[model samples]
Target: MSKEAIVARIEKKPLSMTINGKKIGPIDVPVGMPMIDFLHHYLNLTGTHFGCGEGVCHACTVVEVKSDGSMVDTRTCIANAHSFDGKTIITIEGQAKTDASGNVTQLTPIQTAFIEKFSFQCGYCTSGFIAGATAFIDRLKREPVKRADLETAIEEALNDHICRCTGYVRYYEAVRDVALATPGCVIGQEDKR
Candidate 1:
């Protein structure tokens, strides 16, 4: 076989998904293209930071809403764009409500808490932290953790995420505050009543 015949051509596939509450794609994407590149190059949603690119830093995290409505933190740096086909994903930009003018009208509790607590320094990892924490909060709403387990729960939820600045305390504290403030996130409170 000639060298030209030995080299395989890159295949393109139609990719479509709902991102940040908007339906996007069915556009042709090269197979094996990372989701981060798809989000940045095709959709222009730059809020999902590309950190380690190896999927270890968690800075590329986005929330994938499952069919049952449960959310999971998904890493875009390593996952192929086609892997998200037909899925519902929420990036950091989607966490805030916007007006017709594209101005942010309201930030989700998790986002607000992160800002208030100064949970990030350079802010590169902030998006992933927000996405992970938001998913944790959503889970807590469905299945409240015992008050005694709140600390452990928070740690477990965010353990995989890495932040180079601000240590991990502020992020944990911010999520803790949000979970505690949100009604039904903790279970033991009812026993006290």
Candidate 2:
């Protein structure tokens, strides 16, 4: 096929989604374009880092809040932009509250814990860590884990993320601290007994 014909065959679709509590698009996006590109190039929501481009590193993770109000971490590197149609997603940008002037007024406990614990070095993977940890914490709110299982749960939830800076200890520790501090994230000792 000729280059012109192939170029003409490229498909475009209208994409729309709720991102970070804000409605975005009805914008035309090329089919098969990665969600990461849509976020960075079209919307300029660059906090979702495109690390490793292949979805293995998971530095491009975002939280997709399902219709049932459960959140799942989604990797944007390989997922098509069209796949997120009408979905509600939260990027790293949405983790904190901002004042009317757009200045951040409060950080989510997970975010504050990550900072207080110094959970990252280069910070490239920090967004993914935050998204994953936040979702895990939210899940705990709905289904509290046994106190004894908290550590293993933390490890399981965050184990897939690859941090080149070797900040795993701090990251895991931060999440553990948040889980313990947040009421209902872990079952009470009395309940365990």
Tell me the TM-score of model 2.
0.93
The alpha-carbon RMSD values of the candidates against the true structure, listed in the order shown, are 3.5, 2.9
Q: Model 2 over residues 1-193: C-alpha lDDT tens digits? A: 9999998899999999999999998999999999999999999899999999888998999999999999989999999999999999999998899988989999999999999999999999999999999899989999999888988899999999999989999999999888888898898644321
Tens-place lDDT digits, model 1, residues 77-166 = 999999999999999888899998989999999989988888889998999999999999999999999988888999999999999885
Compared with the true structure, model 1 gives a TM-score of 0.92
Residue-level lDDT for 150 in candidate 2: 85
Q: Clashing residue pairs, candidate 1?
A: none
lDDT of each: 0.92, 0.93
